[model samples]
Target: MDRITALRARRAGIIEQMEAIVASVGENEDLTAEQQSQFDALRAEDDRVAAQLSQAEDLERRRAAAARPAAPLPGVTAPVAGQPAVPAQPAEKGLTFARMCRTIAAAGGIPHVAAQIAEANGDGGLFANQNMGSGPAGGFLVPEDVSTEVIELLRPASVVTAMGPRMVPMPNGNLTTNRRATGANFSYTGEQTDIDATGYTYGQVKLSAKKLAGIVPISNDLLRASSTAVDRMVRDDVLADAAQIQDRFFLRGSGTDFAPKGLRWQALGTPFATTHIMTMTATPDLQKVTNDLGRMELALGNANLPYTGAHWTMSPRTAMYLTNLRDGNGNLAFPEMQDGQLRRKPVHVTTEIPDNLGGGTESEIMLVLPQHVLVGEHMGIEIAMSTEAAYKDSSGTMQAAFSRDETLLRMIMQHDIGLRHLAAVSVLTGVTWGAA
Candidate 1:
């Protein structure tokens, strides 16, 4: 039996012995002083045992009371291992920010931030700051091309617009030809060429639009995904560009003059290389994009995701992504964010599209611009620094860290594509001046 049950049995036996002693004492008429003293000692011992039993009984009662079932929490489900999981209610939607992060991580993307916000504003519509990161902002939504079928899904393909190292071949006529009968003259030639695929690629997908200013601050966790995506695009795209192709030969860093986009550095006070300027031609393949998104969803769906805006949009270049900041060592860091969150943060990273930079139907601007504008030129870089943690410390000092980790770079693609495509593209590639 359990300890409680044993204690009860012992107490019952003690009570019976006490009662027998009391009865014997009452029946005896003339007891000697010695007998009386012995009886009194036995009575004292019995009283002590009774007090111990009372305390034990009280403890047992309390434990039994505590073991009773409790009414379940309204929306919450019964806890497993004494901790409740996501709620069971439909409105509660069972989706958790942590789970979303896991899903994004599974997708080979980073899920930096995840949290739920107020569902509505003072006006009663769902509040815009309801999600905090790039993964599961609200509930999980199926990506456009994801399928229950196996073998059909794949990760997004990496494209390298540049090339790797190589050597030029001599003319075929110079090698092993009939010099007498065919009357061919032969000569040998060897030429060395450098293949430099040092530049990165940036792409955009559109999303729904909503004003988020003064509604919520973009958390540090959410920014991690973007930082990671930029890094992956840099590394993979760089390697891909380095690989030589039959039609397009690879270029080298030494060949900066011929380098695509002149080693596009995100933000530098001056140009790094004049030869790196290269143009991009979009090869639109709908099937490829669908497969990429499907893979992204599959990878992220299994992770704990941070809160983020459900809609997402991507662009090759924007102002928030163009600024270059340095440490004491002068290393590069690029500041960037989606337009909606940028507006909410108001950190001087982005500008109004049509403000001082006049002449645009679009409504966005790059908060950071070159001190001197170069007509028909866009600066480029394979990878740029991203903010690790930007916040005021205990001393009220604003502190931040650069995201130099490549693993983190590959993790940022877990943003919600469904939400991102709804908004119009509003990045300012050029500045406008007021009417002269």
Candidate 2:
């Protein structure tokens, strides 16, 4: 069964045990110390289950709201000519993300408070299943609409994600897909000739959930604000921070027990890391620069890989350098830069690819087939707010939230990334294509 159903059953079992313990007591007889302790433990466990269930139900609500159509507003006027009708706003009184966070924080991270806020905003169904969504420092699920906003923000900010990689659902936190390992042998056979038994080889690609979490302390006043500007401001804050962090991991993460293996790590080892991976030479020669670009594509092309979904990625510095490259005749070296493309494919530039490789002056360029990048998503973003929690900063110094009147917002996402085919990536290291 799914987590929510299991939790519901577990909570029911705990409730039955608690009832039995209460029944063991005689009329007007107080429970023994052990009984009281057991009861308290069961109560706490129930609360935790209820909290998880509440969040799961919230996620279900968001999913339902996202899937179903919004009810039309009563007494609303018709749209103007030649203009698409504005769909009714989904949330009432502008139940913006900031407003939800403010409500939760104001309630001191109480989940029932979220239920109250949802009800007040005409969304009684948000927590109708179980209302204790916040269990201590645990967080609430981001609303579906807001979660969508996060995705919109994620694009253009996260280079890999912006390219629209293949999304695979990991509902059970694990997935395995069969990948073709070899082409089937084929040969012409006459009508009476014995047919040769040949079959395509296959391999398995596995994905498991990995947790990515981030914590930030926001000004209490920020969450407490009533203006819609606060909503946009806080959303932007999350967008900028989340984009950078996600891109960094997606680009250079060491595939360990912690973070999912990124493209850089995927490029390592095998023939790709050596021969398939190209090395760059610094020069202002227009032909030479274009030659280097050709070699990168040839690495995959020689392997019979398709070029349908190919794209280029480099640092901003590399992109600007290539954009302005000029030969002695003053003609642009790569004219496709005007169309936001390179080598006739789209380009994504991010600073996550460092320039410190090879004596600290070199950077790298990546040409990728976006379709080969697989993202296994377990769930959308989850957020928890706390007013009394203490957090450690980058310096490992503890910062007290209550002391500073700050709200600690912790966000967690569970997902993993993999390459459907490692050969789909080509990298050029020690790149000085844009260097003077």
Q: What is the lDDT of residue 108 in candidate 1?
A: 35
Winner by lDDT: 2
lDDT by residue (133-186, candidate 1, tens digit) is 323322222222211110011111111111111111222211111111112334
Estimated TM-score per prediction? 0.16, 0.74
Model 2: which residue pairs collide?
none
lDDT of each: 0.28, 0.77
Backbone clash count for every predicted candidate, in the order shown: 69, 0
